[model samples]
Target: MKFDAILDPDSSPHEVCELGLLAESYGLNAVWTSNYPSSRDPFINLCPLALASSRIRLGPLVVTPYEMHPYKIAKALASLNELCGGRANILTGGPTGVNATMGMDFSRMVGRTRECVEILKRANPDEALNYEGNIYQVRGYKPTWATDEPPFIYIGANKKQMTHMATGIADGLMLGDTTERRLGSSLRLIEDNLATHGRSRDDLAVSCLIAWHVKEDKKLSSSEAKRHLALRGMLDIWFLETFLDAEECKIVDANRANIFTAYKQKTDVIEGVPDAIVDKLVENLSMSGDYDDIDGHIETLKRYRDMGLDEVAFKLHEDQAAAISVIGERILPAFQSH
Candidate 1:
């Protein structure tokens, strides 16, 4: 499995670009940024990365349809691709959490996202794309110049309907919440959808996003895991409940309820979480542990490869440079040997 880095929007552009350059130097595949409403604009922030890194591909891991029109996405992507000599990828998603956070409507996000992808494809190759849809309309829109090739367009999806639509229309599929069992089921869903379209599994690249925190100290690892889960759990409750199973959804909802209840009761459930509880939470929600002495991380990644994931992007939560170094010094070499 190939490794990539995800830049948090809270990070500064200079920090993101520096990490991108370091990732490139470490021989990683790409650097993707989040497009959450509160975050910095990914395309704009990526300019320094485009100028600084020669090889690492840059793009949003997934931009929401409600946040920007396809025309703008196409324009930004085209410009970035040209500037980077054709090393940009565009990953998009139907608006959910982002829209909710930004107070944008999510009702027409799926239809809008489809139209956006079509517009992007047409806008590439310097062709005027005339599009009219329920949510957006574009007439005779084309970029001034085109790159050698259009950026790869991936769709972020987690539910059955979204998976089917993505497999039918997208260049690739991006999945998150990457536990081994979840990865297996997600790949199966993608394969099943592709088969329905009379397409082979090889026709699409499956990218899994794993929330990762690396540390040698068990206590620190546990704390990091708790912090990650608290944030992700809140987001999932707000946006991803539809993608989860009944039991999983219950857990998320119950957790959210508990957190809110604690808030109302003038207490802090999140702060009071102990190390043991954090360890359990990490095991349930994230792919993290000590990756220094043994090949545990490598073996876990190989399991992802075995499950038919084409790529695995580690969404590092801390210390980007050190994370890259660990991946370069330990994880990448292990994968290459295999």
Candidate 2:
């Protein structure tokens, strides 16, 4: 299992760079800039990181196709990869509701992503690229410098069709809204789809993004985990529900109903949630505990490795420095040794 730090949208560009440097020092595999409405331009923010770190790979955890044309994304990534001496990655995703907050249309997001990826693959670092697709067209497109080939393209997908397309095209797949118990099922789905297309698991690199909060104080960890769940749960209710077993989903469904009911009644959901309830939510959805007591977390990752995962990117829900240090000092070492 490799560790990567996720840049918070609230963090400034300089702060993100600082976190990137700290993550590198802590032996993290990569630093991923998130593309959200509130986030700084990912490419702009990551340029400083490229200048600061010699080896740590940097790229967007996701750059949606709705926000920018594929040609521009390819150019940005190519430039970054050249600057970093070929240590760049591009994680592309379809549009989300969040994009609507930025006034972007989500209707054709997936189609646009598919079209963009096709165009991106045809692009070489310095060679002229001429592409024509339903959503994008580029004529005489090329990179100026020649240091390395284009960065590998990975797709962040969940649906069957998208997963199948990604398996056939992308170098890697990024899984989001994952839990230990749900991972196996997701992998099985992907494997079945790949087999139907006459492809094997070896042809794809699978990486999952899992939520985690590590702290010395168990109470603090539990509280943070609940807040994290509430925020993510609100954004991706159905996706989060997919992680729970039937019995667990029943519990979550009941809680979710109650939470929404309270909102309707003008009650504060956070105030209504007791610590015990929060802890239960944490146990069901996230990896939370002291950094030293991460044996269970390591075991969960081992299960993912057995399920054909190439890497696991921990999406930390705390201060950037703390997350990097804990993952580097505790999580990475434990997994590497195991």
Whose TM-score is greatest here?
Answer: 1
Leading candidate by lDDT: 1
Instruction: Give all TM-scores, in the order shown.
Output: 0.87, 0.86
Per-residue lDDT of candidate 2, residues 224-265 (tens digit): 666566544352445546544455555555576565554345
Per-residue C-alpha lDDT of model 1 across residues 1-338, encoded as one tens digit per residue: 67888876687889888889999988999899877657788888888888878888888757766777778888888888887788888889776457778777667556777887877777745567788777778888756678556788888877778888889878888887655666677789999999999889888888877777777665566556555564443445323433545555555555665544543453334644344443555665566667563377677778788878888777776666877888888888877854
TM-score of 2: 0.86
Candidate 1 lDDT for residue 231: 45
Badly placed stretches (over 4 Å) of model 1 are 231-252, 257-278, 292-294
lDDT against true structure, model 2 = 0.73
* Model 1 pairs whose backbones collide: none
